[model samples]
Target: MSAETDLIKLYSQRILALAADIPHLGHLDAPDGSARKRAPLCGSTVTVDLIIADGRISDFAQDVKACALGQAAAAVVGANIIGCTRDQVQTARDQLAAMLKQGGPDPHAPFDGLQVLGPARDYKNRHASILLSLEATLDAFDAATATSASSA
Candidate 1:
């Protein structure tokens, strides 16, 4: 297939649809933690705000200013993030990275939907944008943990 075809495949109808309907697409008020990350190559940015209770995410929100791939990723995570533990989010992020960078398996269930981005594996420059939402979420989780530690 031609390069144009590859680009078309990367932005399929499903991806566009997901992008159009991202969940939790805003900041939370007085969130327990917040973090922002930018993909320098694409100038894509994602910011995540979350609250943790009993070591699981109790509430989550994100503001995404990125391409369709990034929006789709944020949509998936936001739709499933509630009640998740930090380890679950971290594992999903690591698995998605491996899938994109090392020909590894798709992220486990819940995050397995990220396999829709398989075509993006060949586009190195887009990788960072695609991973932006999860990166911000992880950072937010770390921030929440630190805050709890300091308050203890």
Candidate 2:
């Protein structure tokens, strides 16, 4: 097989693995909060529901629909961010964006299984889809925190 074909195969296999292992794939339900993000160009959407306690994420889930890249990215995000605090998630978001945009400060260690998406950085159009879940989760966290702060 050609190199392109090999890459495609690898990506497909990785996506499948992620889908299988993701804790919540279709509809994430959490008691504390929910947030949704959409990429109109690709019609990719992800809704993240989070339950935070004691300033740490106690539970999290996601509902996602998109292409293979989007779904895989969502799965990776959902799996990795479950126990993280809001600050950690924000750091991850910054690291991921940097990796995609500048190829700097590789967070591959924290990224864990998501290293498979390294190949996706080369595809500009796919970036939005891959980032959908992360963005939505961050937005949700921010909104939730703000609400909590105001209520307190």
Candidate 3:
């Protein structure tokens, strides 16, 4: 298939709609943890802020400035992140990376919507953008936990 056709398939209406309606958008004030990640190839970026309590995310928000694929991924994360544990986010990230890089299956529930990004697998350069939200989220989680550990 042609690159144009691939692009068209990668940016389906569902992805566009998800990109337009990303939930938990924006930043948090004095969040427990925060992180920002950028995709150098496309200059796409995602910044995440989160609060962790009882080992699960209690609040979350993100500032996304990325391509449709990235935004769509962020939308899925935002919509289902409120009560997720770090392990859940890590597994989702790992599964997504595998799907894009290792010909693995789609990520599981709470993040199954990530399947919309499957068409992006051929575009290796776009993979980082697609994973930006989840990466930043994991970084934020690490930051929060590190702080908690230091204070304890």
Candidate number of the best lDDT = 3
Taking every candidate in turn, the Cα RMSD to the unseen true structure, in Å, is: 0.7, 2.5, 0.8
Candidate 3 Cα outliers beyond 4 Å, as residue runs = none
TM-scores, all candidates, are 0.98, 0.84, 0.97
Model 1, residue pairs in steric clash = none
Best by TM-score: 1
Clashes of each: 0, 0, 0
TM-score of 2: 0.84
Order candidates by lDDT, high to low. 3, 1, 2
Least accurate 10 contiguous residues by lDDT in model 1:
109-118
Better of 2 and 3 by TM-score: 3
**Model 1 agreement with the true structure over 42-112: per-residue lDDT tens digits:** 99999999999999999999999999999998888888889999899999999999999998999997788
For candidate 2, the C-alpha RMSD (Å) to the true structure equals 2.5
The C-alpha local distance difference test score for the whole of candidate 2 amounts to: 0.75
- Give one digit per residue, the lDDT tens place, for model 2 in 67-122: 78777777777767877887777777777777777775555544555666777676
Output the TM-score of candidate 1: 0.98
Compared with the true structure, what per-residue lDDT tens digits does model 3 show for residues 47-118?
A: 999999999999999999999899999999999889999999999999999999998999999999998899
